[model samples]
Structure formats: C-alpha cells, structure tokens
Target: MDSQAISVEILKWMLEVQCKEALVPALLYEKKVRSQYGKAENVQPVKGVLSKRALQVNAPGRDIYGLEKSTEVRYFECPNCERQVAGHRFAAHIARCSGRGRR
Candidate 1:
C-alpha cells in the first residue's frame, strides 16, 4: 500500500483501540472514520432482495406531503427579471419579481 493508504489504515487501528479502551465512543469512531475515509475499497456493495417485513413496513406510496411524484421539472422565464423559475415556484417568483423595479 502507498503511504496515504497506510496512514489511513493506521488511523483506523488507533481509533478502534481508543474505542475498545473506552477513551472514545464507538459511534464517534465510526462517524469519524466514515466521514474521513469513506467506504473501504475492498468491500463490495451487496445487492439483494429486501425482506418481507421490510417490504410491508416500507411499502412505497405517495409521500407524506400528499403530492404525487412528477418526474418532469418545468421552468418558466420571468418577464420582469428574465430569470428561469421552477414551475411550482413560478407564481411566487412572478409576484416578487413584478413587485420590484425592472433593471
């Protein structure tokens, strides 16, 4: 391994030792290592089917906001400031833009 990889592995070992000795919280060590080194290159992401319990509990449906999912995003150009605003927020944008003096 190169110097940088070696250093990261050494740091990980030190963090684990500190965690085992109760000098640092296990959660903190996990968070620090994750935030700094990210995922290990040797580990492969597992792809599998979800459990029946997970499927039942996490059944996909309309979001809590009750708005149906629309994949397409539409943009409208503001006549006053000539800024492109998202379709959902266009009304509010127009109100604010129209209230101000045109450049």
Candidate 2:
C-alpha cells in the first residue's frame, strides 16, 4: 500500500484507541469516500400515463353560488386578454383585464 493508505489505517486505529467518539469522524469519512467513488447506475425518469381529458370532473355538483354543474352556460374569450371568462364574470373581467388596462 501507499504511504497515504498506511497512514489512514494508522489514524483509524489510533482513533479507536483514543476514545469511542473519535471513531465517529473516521467512520463518517469512510462513508463519504465510499459514496463518492462507488459504482452507481444511471437513472432515468418515467412518464405518467394520465391525459388532460381524464382529469376533468363533469359530474353534477352545485357550486357555492347554487350553480349546477350540468347546466348549460356561456363562456366568453376576452378580446384583450388570454383568459376565457365565464359569461357571468366576462363583463367585469374585460373591464379589469391586465392586457387592456396596462401598457
């Protein structure tokens, strides 16, 4: 073995003889060294199988304002904004649109 390896073994042995707490530092160093130089595999991420259409809840449920989910409602696309506002809130939404108010 090289001089560095010999000294490492000697240091570890001395720590073991000095006190029980001294061995903790040597053990932690050994763990870190092994982790840095150990053989490890290249990992790849997996893609989920869920689609956007599968996530919508079309079942009948009442909103806080007593609005039924199954009822037909109008939706408006703002001329100056990217948001698609519901019919009831479209007028208010267009009045306060970020794209319309700010330059």
Candidate 3:
C-alpha cells in the first residue's frame, strides 16, 4: 500500500527472518535517511487501547527547608557588605552600588 505500510511489512518480515545482525545497520541507515528526509510511520498499536498517563498523582511539593510555604522574606548574606539583606532586593542593591562605584 503506502510507504509506511510497506516499511512495517518489511520490518515484520525482517524479524520473522531472524535477521538481528542486519537489523541494527538497517535501523541506523533508516534514522540517517529520516534525519535528512522524513520517514513514514510503520507500526500502529491495537485500536481502542488508551496509552498510560506519564504524570503521577500525589507528587511531593518543592519545599526544601519547609519554608517555601511561609510568607516571610528569606535573607542572604551580602558579598560586598557582609550584611544580611533580603534575597529579592540583594541583586538590585548590588547593581546600584556597583554602578555608583563606577562613576
């Protein structure tokens, strides 16, 4: 029929022939040709069968220190001043200071 159907038939015949050693080289060549010019879909699973979902239910939250849920601002030690400053404002303040230093 179509190229896809033909490819699938060829694959099935190859498997039935027990051509394992030839399969790898054939697959590699197929991949190379597909990479340059797209190939056709060959195999199709049985109809009316739904594929399994990839995502998991009841996944853990990303709270490393159990503080991610907290509303309190996290503080970080400033490299230039060695003082504790709010994490959010630290970078902006550092940029301002550096810009002032350059003037």
Candidate 4:
C-alpha cells in the first residue's frame, strides 16, 4: 500500500465516527501527505466546506474542529428512486432504494 494512502478505519474515525484528538493530527498529516503527492490543494474537505489546507490556513497550529461553523444539510440523489437523501443516511437509503424499481 502507498504510504500516503489512509486506511479505511482511520479515515472512517477521522471523518465520520467523531472524536477530535486523533483527527486533528491526522488531518495535519493528511495535508502533508497530499502535499507530497501534489494534491495539497484538496486532501479532502471538512464537512464538504473547507479543504484541509484551508482549515490550516484559517487557523494555524490550532484545532480546526473548534472552528467548524453551522453545518448545512447535504443531500445525495438516489439513482434508483430519483429522490434526494440526506448525506448521513444516504448509505442506508441507497441500499434499500436500489432494490426497488424506479417509479
């Protein structure tokens, strides 16, 4: 595996399953890794708003999690139903929706 590639578990914990102490350092390291790969501009977005680099730029050497502002509802279109599903629940929605024929 490439050294820059993050494991699914780490990525999941960092982005989804909460907890910030580990996330803060992980984000910083992800930035460095992306920079090395020439993808420094967008390692990944924090809540799809600010890029990892932007977060660092906005608050140097501080926890970016503290700076997170109000989050907006994000939706994804379900291919099977042509319905919008909330991002957080899209996985479950898609799983169920995919089994049904399109209306």
Candidate 5:
C-alpha cells in the first residue's frame, strides 16, 4: 500500500479503538444509575424555594463504603429560569427572584 493509504488505515484503527474504550465506561455508568434509581416509585420532583441544604452535588470521590461516592455536595436549581447556580449563593439568588425553584 502507498504511504497515504497506510496512514489512513492506522488512523481508522485508532479511532475505532478510542470509540470502543469510551463506550464501555459510558454503558457501565448508565447501567449503574438505572439500577440505583429505577426501582424507586415514590421519587418526587424537587420543589419549593431553593435551599443550599437541599441541593446535592456528587463530588468525584471515594466513600466509606469503598464505593466511589456519586454525590458529594448539594446545590439548587431554578426550574423557571433554567439557571444553574452553585453553592450557598444559589439559595440567596432564588430567594430574590420570583422564578420557579427546584433542588
């Protein structure tokens, strides 16, 4: 094969390998989330004024259970404005605005 053809073949193989590697981890995560939350029937949508205490952000870290902790912190979201504010300031921002709230 010509040099250009050989380079193209190598590039194609690299792309295929990268795609497969990326896909495996994503599929695993999807399966885990589904199994964890899928069985809960009474899960309610978050509502009311935003509270810093109400929000939870899963910091990427290990937990005591030896499981990689999914959620490490909490924050609030505004469903009305679709604004995502982080930390304690989100609560104050929600309080001042008349928008619909979520957590």
Candidate 6:
C-alpha cells in the first residue's frame, strides 16, 4: 500500500467506535482539555442544566455497576408516546413515531 492509502486507513481506524471512545479522550487529555473543574466546583447550575458532567469528565469509570445504564447515556421521554429514548436516537425515533399517526 502507498503512503497515502496507509494514512487513509489510519484515519478510518481512528473513526471506529472503540477507537473513537479511546482516542478522542486521549487526544483531549494530551491537550489538557477538561469539561469541568476548579472555581465551578460549587457553583449551582440552573434547574435543568447538566449537573453530572463533572463526575463524567473526571471520573469516567466510576460506574462500577458495569451495566449499560451505568454509562453516560442520555435519556428523555417522548412527549407523545411517553417512551423513554436515548438522547442520540430521540430525534429519529420521534419523527418515525409521529409518522405512525400517534403523535
């Protein structure tokens, strides 16, 4: 394989799911990036804002229960069917659900 092809393969590997979960955070850490810290240690957020991010960013593996729910999965209730869906799939699910004539 040519050098360009090898580089393309490297990029594709980086984009894989497991690769992304590992690589992205490592890259961010290399750059000393942090989602929360310091002075905000005790600042109270608005009622509906993200309050758990600090726990996540600083303590990624604290979910020793090892269940899927223990992961940082975002959940929301669909207003129409009231089905709880993960935040990542909420939009597509709601659209399909509304098309089914329920919402």
Go through the candidates in order and give the clash count of each: 0, 0, 0, 0, 7, 0
Model 1 stretches with alpha carbons more than 4 Å out: 1-68, 100-103
Q: Which has the greatest TM-score?
A: 5
Tens-digit lDDT track of model 4 for 4-103: 5657657886666466776888999989998788664545534758766675657744545545454688988988788999988998888677764355
TM-score of each: 0.31, 0.26, 0.31, 0.31, 0.36, 0.29
Name the TM-score of candidate 6.
0.29
lDDT of each: 0.78, 0.73, 0.72, 0.73, 0.71, 0.73
The numbered model that scores best in lDDT is 1
Candidate 5: which stretches are off by over 4 Å?
A: 39-103
Candidate 5, residues 1-103: lDDT per residue as tens digits? 9999999999999999999999999989989998987843675656775544333333335444445665546666776577877765777777666644544
Candidate 3 segments whose C-alpha is farther than 4 A from its true place: 1-69, 100-103
lDDT (10s digit) by residue, model 3, range 46-87: 688644431122224424443335567999887777888898
Task: Write model 2 residue lDDT over 1-103, tens digit each, in one string.
Answer: 9999999999999877787677778888888988999855686644785444433433338554445565777888988767788999987788788555554
Please give the ranking of all candidate structures by lDDT, highest first, separated by commas: 1, 6, 2, 4, 3, 5
Candidate 3: residue 90 lDDT (0-100): 88
Where does candidate 1 have its weakest 10-residue lDDT segment? 59-68
The lowest-lDDT stretch of 10 consecutive residues in candidate 3 is 53-62
Root-mean-square deviation (CA) per prediction = 13.3, 15.5, 16.3, 19.7, 17.4, 16.6
Candidate 1 per-residue lDDT, tens place, 1-103, comes to 8999999999999999877888557668888999999965785545796655555555566344544556889999999889999999998888778775355
Question: Model 2 misses residue 16 by how many Å?
Answer: 99
Candidate 6 lDDT over 11-72, as tens digits, reads 88867967879988897875664444423356567876654655465564554343233557
Cα-based lDDT at residue 36, candidate 2 = 93
